[model samples]
Target chain A: MAALLPITHLLWDTWRGNLTVNPLQDWTFRTGDWALRLLVASLACTPIATIFGFKQASSVRRALGLYGFGYAVVHFFIFIGVDYRFAFDLIWDDLATKRYILVGLVALLIFMPLAITSTRAWMKRLGRQWKQLHKLTYIAVPLAVVHYIWLVKADLRDPLLYATIVAVLLLLRLPWVRTQISKLKYRRVFQKL
Target chain B: MAPKKTIMKIYSSEITPEQTYYAQSQSRRQFFKTAGLVASGALLSACAPSTPSTVDPAPTAIKPEKPVTAGQTDELGDAITQYDAISNYNNFYEFTTDKQGVAQMSAGFVSSPWKVQVGGLVNNPKTFDIDDLRKIAPIERIYRMRCVEAWSMVIPWSGFTLSNLLKQVDPKSEAKYVRFETLLDSNRFPGQRDRSFPWPYTEGLRLDEAMHDLTLLATGIYGKPLLPQNGAPIRLVVPWKYGFKSIKSIVKIDLVAEQPTSLWMKSGPSEYGFYSNVNPEVSHPRWSQSSERRIGEMARRRTLLFNGYADQVASLYAGMDLRKNY
Candidate 1:
């Protein structure tokens, strides 16, 4: 339910005529931005659960990943469907020439299987294979960040900041780092209690 | 009206139908009615009247005419972009990098007491007041501004030709290029504080490009004094080149012996070139420039070589490799 807010806010802005002069660019950027943020947030869930010992955090990871995938689909739809008007020639030209768009497409492709197998039936069927396949989140998040950093003309602060967060979250997921931090955190919690 | 009549002679080929132009003009005026009320109210309380306005120009000088003339559109017959969109959406990186945010960030910016210094390798060096510069030969020009980011706008700008200004300060025999520098006050322009860019943003053009009659030193837009975000007081309008080549809020003009490296060229030598002419065939390093979305239009149109100004400016770059130069 909370995932609907970004699109709702965008629709309200569109209705109010409060969008930027180039509404298409605004829509594309906003949707892409939300997709990246949600995907990164999905990546951060396990790290948070391990480090802070919040067991409940892992439960929503699937939902967050699904939401991120949903936004990515809309982002691509806006680009190829609305903006390009399904002009395969122009779209093909962009895919061939534009590096950032190509990277974004690859990242979206990675998210697709993860989103499709998110159901409990599929997850249980795949079992350990599902976990290994979903590990591709680690790859998808960084590619999305690279897509952002490459697309921006000069300012890299926003994208770089996301890159740093993703780096730290990934570092925390390392077995040694996770076990050490988790032990230290639980020990401190018991002392406080 | 006399000034308007004379300026129309320059763009006598404008072929927009009379009825379509009238309907557009009527709706434009209606938009201005609401926009002007809000603008005047905000402008009155926020800033003093030191900023020159076409609303009340000196009786002796040519003032920008309104209701833009019948069939007065760009050479491509593209309808003039709405004044609100043109003013409200800007790429004045001095204030902010966000296109729509520049207007709000530049609120109450003071462009008064501005003096543009014309010197360096010139026979006659002079510093002219911004107002005096506008008086030289202010005329309205409808131009298609294509950004390197694959977006474009059709704007009606009011200013004199850069050739008129360049001629005043006669270039020395060895002067081969013209370098321009923006005002460097970090306090007024917050974006300068960021070290990512070499501030007092600098840009340059070849001497012949600077002398082209089509190149304008714009001081106003939409028949009004330029808004702060639109590079008020004075800016350059090189229609053939990408929009960034038309630098804003200029303070210094130098006729140099060598091609001066512009800020973009210094920052990304591979992406931006000295001549940043608009050519669809030569794409930017990261993005395709084969097509562009006009500000109001939804679908992308084929990007034109030299932004549809090739007829007038192509001779200037004859026998040269535009791809190499770009």
Candidate 2:
């Protein structure tokens, strides 16, 4: 429902003939927003699962991560297809001159490995290493935020909001949060005894 | 579905005798029209070769205006192709930033009722209607229009020189710049309410630039009344500068003593400058201006200096630092 809202808004604007600013810019911004939302949703899954004692909500984490990957791919392609117009020369020029585009390309490249290894079979094969490799999201999230902040000129409000959300989510996974989880587990074990 | 079928059946059967008679009569009328056309065709064939052919000569047979002078061949001058001339029209951004949208929405403008208010530092502030302005001397000049967006067009525009028009207004010695304001009717222009950019577009030129011979208060393009999107009634066309320098659909031409605030500059000072000349060396902050894709020209064609009218306008910017002016 949350993803549908922004898509509907974009449709309304397009129907109203108000898509004057390059469609690529609109596509990139919307995809980036959706990717951030998905990442936030993935982080919220564990909290919701613990609070409600419903393991089903945690099952959505994989889907949310994949959604983030989907949107990131869309954002990357929109930049290449519309902005660069598939001109290799122009793309090369932009990569050289625009540091933000370079950082964004790098962030997308780093996310590609995680996206490819996201399947259940690969997860099972990697076993314990799967959890460690997937922790790259911690790095990828902030890098993506920085990429967005660098791209925008004189408008830090939206990027700052995303950064704040990602920061809070990451902070929620600190040693204190682990100690609290351990205390809760100990209380549950003692209560069962 | 059954009810709809019944409704359609009744609608078709409702036709009375009088309606049927009228329908039959209409077909008969059409037959007579066809017969008349056939008879005219036959008559034309019969008279085709006889009586030395009294039919009127082709309208194009009329004597050409400005006949070629002695020893002057049509091939002597550098000819701009008709396709290039037609397609290279610099789109006015008032209706919409989309090049085609400007062309579409301009049709709604009623240019006949147009009036221009000339005020500010001018001694004789006056308003001139479309007819009043047309009565003045008209000169046709073919010049290139370069857009700040890195596209360019060459156009043959017809209008009186701005210097000649300015002489009537008699600007005070303090008048150092001329600012033009486009018509601001949101009802007619849907793009006015767009928040993406400012509306009631404004542009300005230095006093000397305004008074230059290359500057014109244009009313027509391609020898026709200016298209609505092309700044009908009147617009300022500075051939050597970017297209935005030529403000369109001008409602007011203010002879300001001070440097007038320009719309683009006020919105983003770094991106737009006051004197937006066509200099390849000085690139726009967001994009390069070294080359422009001339609309409808082959993509590989090189951009020209002063957009290929350098001989005419090169002297205008001579001794001036183009980078600073740009």
Candidate 3:
């Protein structure tokens, strides 16, 4: 339900012609923006649940991942179907030349295996290996952030902010790092004693 | 009522394929209208005091508050982007990188009582007041402006030819290039503080390119004086080149022996070039220029060589490679 907001707004804007001068660009940006936001959100669930001791928060991680993949597919479809008109040669050229597009495509492909095996049946079939394979999200999330970084021309504030957020989230997920942080907080207390 | 005349027809050659593409554009064409356009036209017509508008004899000239005759170009049937859209959404990076932020920031910019220095390798070096330029140049033209970002718009611009201004200050035999400099006031333009590239933004044109009839030194569009955000007082309008080539709020015009390095060319030599012509065949390093989204329209149209002015300006690049130069 939360994921439908970007989709709904896109529909509303398209209907009213509310998108800025470049409607295609506006549409592409919004869809891609949401996909990245959701990817980041899914990555947060584990650390957020562990740190806050909110066991129930862990349940929404798969849902967020699936929804992010949905938006990713839409973003990819818009690029190819509308922007390129399914021109394979043009797509090939963009993929070859544009480093941002290449990174973005790699990010999208990373989500494919995780999304396909998201269902309970596939999770059960894959068993213990599923957890290790899904760890690829750590790599995918950073690539997606890098893709955003390359697209921006001058202003780096927004992209830099997102990078910082993703970096912090990744740090919180590392068990060794979390233990070190926990010890640092108590280190000063022990010295007082 | 003022008589609307088809001003000057420079190109007599056969219509190019690119021109035909604009005529029979695949997408549905919709040019939006704004109340500002009609309002400005009426205001300008009311302000003119029955004197001839073409040439003011004195240096202390009145602001060009009147509208120039903007007649349609022959065989160019693309619907124009309305006054408001053209005025609002733009890439005047001097003010701010944010498209919408420029208007507010540039409101305090004092363009009146401005001086443009025309110097360097020219036979005669002189600085002309902005008002004086208004009195001398009264030609207006409707042109299609395409940005390097793969977006475009058609606008009715009121101004005069760059050649007319260039001829006034005759170029010396050694002058191979014409370099332009925009007013670099960091006080008003916050973006100037960013030292990512050189400040006092610069652009250049080969001597022959500067002499082209299509090149214009525009003062206003849709009737009234150009809004502060739209490069108030004066700016360049190079139709065939990327919109960045049309530097805003120009203050300096230098005729140099060597090809002057423009802002983008200086910063990113690979991505931007000296000859930034509109070409469907040659793509930007990051994005494809094969197609562009017309500002008011929903669908993208295939980009054109010299922005459909190939027949007129292609001769300037005869026997030379465009891709390599680009």
Top candidate, metric lDDT: 1
- Candidate 1 lDDT over residue span A31-135, tens digit each: 999998888888888877866668888988887788888888999999988888888887888888789989999999998888888898998999899999989
At residue B55, what lDDT does model 3 achieve? 31
What lDDT tens digits, residue by residue, belong to model 1 across residues B15-122? 332233444556766644544555555656667674535443222111123334543566567877776788788888899988878989999899998999999999
**Candidate 1 Cα misplacement greater than 4 A, ranges:** A185-193, B1-72
Give fnat for candidates 1, 2 and onward, in order.
0.55, 0.00, 0.39
Model 3 misplaced stretches (Cα beyond 4 Å): A182-193, B1-74
Ranking by lDDT: 1, 3, 2
Q: Is candidate 1 or candidate 2 better by lDDT?
A: 1
Q: Which lDDT value does model 3 have at B128?
A: 96
Q: Of the pair 1 and 2, which is ahead by TM-score?
A: 1
- Candidate 2 residue-wise lDDT, A1-193, digit = tens: 3555666787788688555333444566787788777867887777668744679979888888778777888778766675455667655654765566677777778788898999989999999999999888888878888877876543367889988988877876788986887788889989999
Candidates sorted by TM-score, best first: 1, 3, 2
What DockQ does candidate 3 score?
Answer: 0.52
Give model 2's docking category. Answer: incorrect
The DockQ value obtained for model 2 is 0.11
